[model samples]
Target: MKSERERQLMEQAYAEIEKYQDLVHRDPYRLRYHLMPPVGLMNDPNGLIDWNGTYHVFYQWMPFRTGHGAKFWGHYTSPDLVHWQAEPIALAPSEWYDQNGCYSGSAIDDDGKLVLFYTGNVKDDQGNRQTYQCMAVSEDGIHFTKKGVVINLPDGYTAHFRDPKVWRKDGLWYMIIGAQSKSGDGKAVLFRSSDLCHWEHLGPIAGGNSKWLGPFGYMWECPDLFPLDGQDVLIVCPQGLQPDGMRYQNVYQSGYFVGRLDYGRAEFVHGPFEELDRGFEFYAPQTMLDRNGRRILIGWMGVPDQNEDRQPTVGHRWVHALTLPRELRLVDGKLRQTPVKELKQLRKQQVAYPNAVVANELRSWPGVEGDAIELRLDRIQLLGSMMEIHFRHAARLIYNSDEGVLTLERKSFVNGLTETRQCRLPRLRSLHVFLDTSSIELFVNDGEETFTARFFPYPDDRTMFFGAHGHLQMDIEKWEL
Candidate 1:
């Protein structure tokens, strides 16, 4: 039963919805085609599934303010993954098990009904935390009936265990959860169930305790295990990760391991962990197979404990958005992700410039500037040591051919100083850039690597400049989204 506290929270959320809608109506940094909270704050796309011919996405949402607190599962439905409509809030943190928050989880279609498996978080008077693996069911994919806690905390692990990802394989249900041991080390535990409720623990598959992976991270937050192109993939977000050169530069790290899962032994024989996104603002990515059999994934476009108050959108009463829905493919034992084809519906007023020359000076082309747009550069030959793309004078994308490194530079809101994040690539060929009002996604070389980040540019500054130290030939296309 929904409690009085939940009812009061819902009323406040609705009131803030109306107020934030009016307040952000004139906000210039609002996203045009991305999914963002209507009010307050949003993080970690959860319960992603395709049910009964429609797409459903739930996110960790706190609707009363711009900070993290008791979270509700905010809902959104899409017919083609391009157009989206906000639905009513799903799960509220009102029950005894979830008094603190309803954390991240997954969704599954069970016999024509939608079943949501999530984590219910609680903390007691002494500040001791508790967690439960819970479930809820929806017949019409709109309204849901909470099933409460189905799986409790087992021995040897602390309450940091959460974010259960469930899937059915070979007529048996399997789950993978991110967990922290009582000793405070990251782990991914495996479980199996004949029904969806009662589960049997299968022990840790790969984590800090493993011989190959020694001392990985302090804690793991969101864990997802799935089969992609004949290989098993484990996706997780590990907090308190120290930087490894260009990797793990953010406060936390989200990445995946490609391997084969031995169901008999419940072991994952895998490769080294590789980061999924090399960006400043990416975490807690979740993936699901759609009706078309495509492994589509979305990630939160903001990181935790980094630049929270520094975000300019907090003044407008909202922050954070989901990355563009990307289709994942396994090519040459590496995961390749590209923007979904349905996003093409947003393309309009296309402009193409073939074989353009970039000399020593910055140059702008006609119809090459907009806040909401898609830019593609292809078939390029670099004759210079350095090349750069200035995005509205607020952000910069630069490539140095000599070092084989591509860099993104932007002014930090905390100290008003320039900061950069970069990744090394073999060569420069093509780039696909998606620009929203407050976000940017750069897919390099047909999704060999991608950089996703949030940027705040002036409303009137819609100019883009491209330049090279020497000279080069390139083809360019821009479409207003």
Candidate 2:
């Protein structure tokens, strides 16, 4: 049931992938166990769902060049979260309504069939833009049928309205979309559908200049709303927030507000916003509930338009990846992210040190070094005010117990100068570190605080250094992942 134009463009995208197969595979910086594009640019994980015992992940892909343009919905499927297989392209910019691009949205299961909701991006010769909330369906989760536009541009909002996240609540289908008001303030709009085809607008639930917040940002992108623990969480990316002290330091910010949603009145009463990840890269996260009843999350490891020209992977016709699937737990008022237990299957070599002590001078353990591995330290008792662990001489994780601050430092992608990002931690207990070829994911104090970043270090340098102003004791374990 595919249109002629849609079928042709998807074939072209497959051909593009085949053309760069060798070049892309030969890149030294390619991820070892992460989901990356076969070629071109990738961003904003979309349509994540666990349907019929299989996990499906789709994303925004530009297949022809290492830059952003009209995107194709590239897909990957997994029986288990650790192993993945690339499937056919889900949506192409072929239909007239979506000829510009098939942008971000979510997925759902409807009567044993897989349903997808996405933004149909259209543009005219003069570069004017129009957006449509569109739908598609698949029998096998591989090929999608474009149902065309189901909803038009509503009144009082700009065409920036996109990234619809839908869920079934109280036997009704509800969707929340990121939007820009006519007055140029960001917001999240609410809608309801009885049959997933017809919809009724429920007005704005939350965002800038709404019931609670002031003018926060000009445009909000990629919104997600779901119930976690005993409360509701709304995650969104808001643009145009200037840096205030230690937070909102990125080009933009991705964070959440915990509150209660009144479905009857279409209102969301929430608390203050808190930053999601204290890292250099981590944004546009999507989540799903698996059969095991775990709320798992994944995010794009690169920010939008943040030193894209400096990315080394583009030389090989590939750039960017999605982070490892992380299990989410709402702890003490904030969400805690930890690597799913399935990732332990990637562990190969095991190295452990019991009651290891480090003091004064920098030192290296005999077998604690690799470009791709996981390091776990438990029951760490610091005898000094400060301790520093350097990774491959490329990045450093420093903790100061006296100042109650933990800092992550790495060389800048734009300039070689050292750059640092910090978050407050009452005390340091455990440090879990994952090191990939060109990236790092640091989970501190049992996921109470986490830092995720991508840094390019010397490929040959796999040594790690640990130093302390005074003696510290801890249990250490390392595994090659």
Candidate 3:
């Protein structure tokens, strides 16, 4: 038996399939299973709210087209965050105020009701952008009713004001929106609201002419602010930042800054910018408070401005997916991310390595073939100049201490595009990696820093290898997906 709302959603989904049958019917991407979207093109996560034993996540979805066009709010709900149920389209850009698209925003549970706040994007006849801060409400957590604009673009702020992340502080509601300065600098502004209907600008929280904060591109997008280990952490994905040394490698990347907030003075005292994830694919991360009072985060696994048309799964209808929710904690003044323990529910067969296994030369683990698996390598002794690990098909991951590079190479992608990123390390000792069918997450030095990537593999590429010239020792544990 299905509820009326569930049946209505089913009918709506069927109708959508019929309407966009040409574009909606495609194969799934070949990357780790966690990185590829289950159905359609998905980007930034919006309206992440945990309410009444269920979690609702809205994303930047494009329904009618295969690429990024006609942005609509796609909804998904999960009781445990591992398995998701697709719901109806929460918001469509069918109205005048949001005819162009409905951009990214946040959600909150206001006294038992789910309140969604998102940016209503509008473009005029000249193709100029107009952003509006809008509101919606849901009682059953599946359907939403728009409440029009709650805040408008203010003076001194450019038209790029979008991605409003709302939170409750003390006794009032506060929002942090990504924006650009008049001189074309990226920043995030704060706002306050006594009632959900009215709002007041509180000026910039950070990212406006700081000596240490570098020119973080033109405008920051998807601003997320939360408290971790007694310090406020701000995560923002900025555009136009050129690669300087080992930072800002992706077309667009997400990072964070740990700081203290003085709400009375409307200012944020922060530290230098730090890359959140050192992976090939990760962008526009969103965070929320779960039922256990933990701050968990999820990020889009695809980069912006990349040639995704070459993705193998384009024929399958979906493109990207959200990373597994990770709990954030501040350790020794640095943000450490770890997968929640709930993910263990998805694990089946477990293989343990009780004693240290030496791979002085290249070694292979039999039956280590699957799209989904959890691997833990402890006390890794890298005695060679370089060592490589292969997953899926031609996905090669190398940790080279001699060259100070940790590279993930995928030659099987569209047009044989192989992307690699490296960070300077004194010496590589230990590595912990998680591999899903279409995604790979590497946690180095026990979560001191991490990398997240999405890869598309060929159907027959399930073999893995550990290649090294000199002696190497490691304790490896493999678990079924």
Candidate 4:
């Protein structure tokens, strides 16, 4: 049963949304193929699941402003991930335990019902924080009934424990949470449950003074554990990761660890933590296996603690959008992410270029200029030290053969000055670029490395230039998304 306060909040939220719809839609930076809040702010993709032939995704939303506050679980649903519709709010922070916010979490199919697991965040008047692993049930996958707190904050962790990702394996339900130890180190704690409502604390399976993994971060925000090709993968976002050469440049980092999880001992024997995206704007990624048995992931396309005010969309009363859904695969012991195959459904007005030779100067393509389109430069013969693709005069993706590094450069949203983020690659193979209205995602070498960022060029500036220092050969294909 819904309380009167929750009902009133919903009514007011709908009114605010209606009032801002036109203003928000008028923003030129509005995305054509990305999931964004109709109003206010969005972060951290949450409660991702495939249920009854529908793809459901939820996010942390602050509908009243383009900043953080008491959050609600905003939802979207689709028959396929390619096309989506904003659904009614799934979970609200109206109850006593969750009055402050309903933070990030995941979802699962409990028998036939859609069950969601998330963190309820509360801050008392004294500034002390409290967290609870909460659950909700949805018969129709739209409206969710709150089941209150299922698991309180366990011992040895601070209130930073949140973002519960629950999955079932071997006839038992398991959960992993992002946490900060009382001693101020990041950790991923484990739990088990036979029934969805009752959970058993299984201790810290990864992070926090582990012998195999050294001190990684001060606090881990979102941890997701799943299976990929017979091996377990743990995806997490850790805060306070200092810059390590070309990686960990952002305020926080989201990455994964490929390993084996010992069920009985509740331990994850894994390799070194690897950054999932070698980019500036990918975080809090969540994955779910689809009906076709493919593991797919989606991430928030903006970074936190960065240029919050400088985003042009904030003037229109919205902040961030989700990345295009990407399919995840374990290739050669590394996670390879490619845009989901269903996105081909959005392709239209195909254009192709035969194998082309490039010289020292950048050249623009006549048919490949658009704010929202897909471009593929394949079969590349890299005969140059540097290959550059200038995106709309605002951002550029540069490949340097000398250092074997791929760099993305863009004007800082804060200072309007040029900045760059880079990652090392062994060799160059192909470049797959997806350009939405205000964002760009570069999938390099068939998704071996990806760079995701939001770049706001002038609305009319759709020109892209391709340049090589010496000479390179590649084919190009593009489709308006």
Worst 10 residues of 4 by lDDT: 1-10
> For residues 274-340, could you state the per-residue lDDT of candidate 2 as single tens digits?
8888889988998998989999999999889788768888899998999889998999889998999
- Candidate 4 has an lDDT of 0.90
After superposition on all CA atoms, what RMSD does each candidate show versus the true structure? Answer: 1.2, 1.0, 3.4, 1.0
Clashes of 3: 18
For residues 1-481, write the lDDT of model 1, one tens digit per residue: 4567777767778888997798866678989999999988899999999888889999999988899987889999999999999997788888898888888999998888899999999989898999999999888888777898989999989889999999999999998999998888899999999889899999888788686587889798899988899999889898888998898889999998899889888888888888888777999999999999999999999998898767999999888999999999999888998999999999999999999999998999999999999999999789989999999888899999999999999877677678888899979899999999878899999999999898877878898999899897899999999
Give the per-residue lDDT digits (tens) of candidate 3, residues 286-381: 999998989988888777777666566667666777788888889988888888778888788988665545455656777656677888777788
Worst 10 residues of 2 by lDDT: 305-314
Q: Measured by TM-score, how close is model 1 to the native structure?
A: 0.98
TM-score of each: 0.98, 0.98, 0.92, 0.99
Per-residue lDDT value at 358 in model 1: 92
- lDDT, candidate 1, at 310: 77
Better of 2 and 3 by TM-score: 2
- What TM-score quantifies how close candidate 2 is to the native fold? 0.98
* Candidate 4 per-residue C-alpha lDDT over 1-481 given as tens digits, one digit per residue, 9 for 90 to 100: 6788787777777887999999999999999999999899999899899899999999999988998888899999999898899899877788888888999999999989999998999999998899999999988888888888999988899999999999998899999999999998899999999998789999888895786788889899889898899899999899988998887998899999999999899999999878988777888999999999999999998788887767889999999999999999999889999998888899999988878777888787678889999999999888878898888888999889999988999977778899999998879999899999889999999999999999889989989888999997889899988
Q: For each candidate in the order shown, give its overall lDDT on alpha carbons.
A: 0.90, 0.91, 0.78, 0.90
Candidate 2: which stretches are off by over 4 Å? none
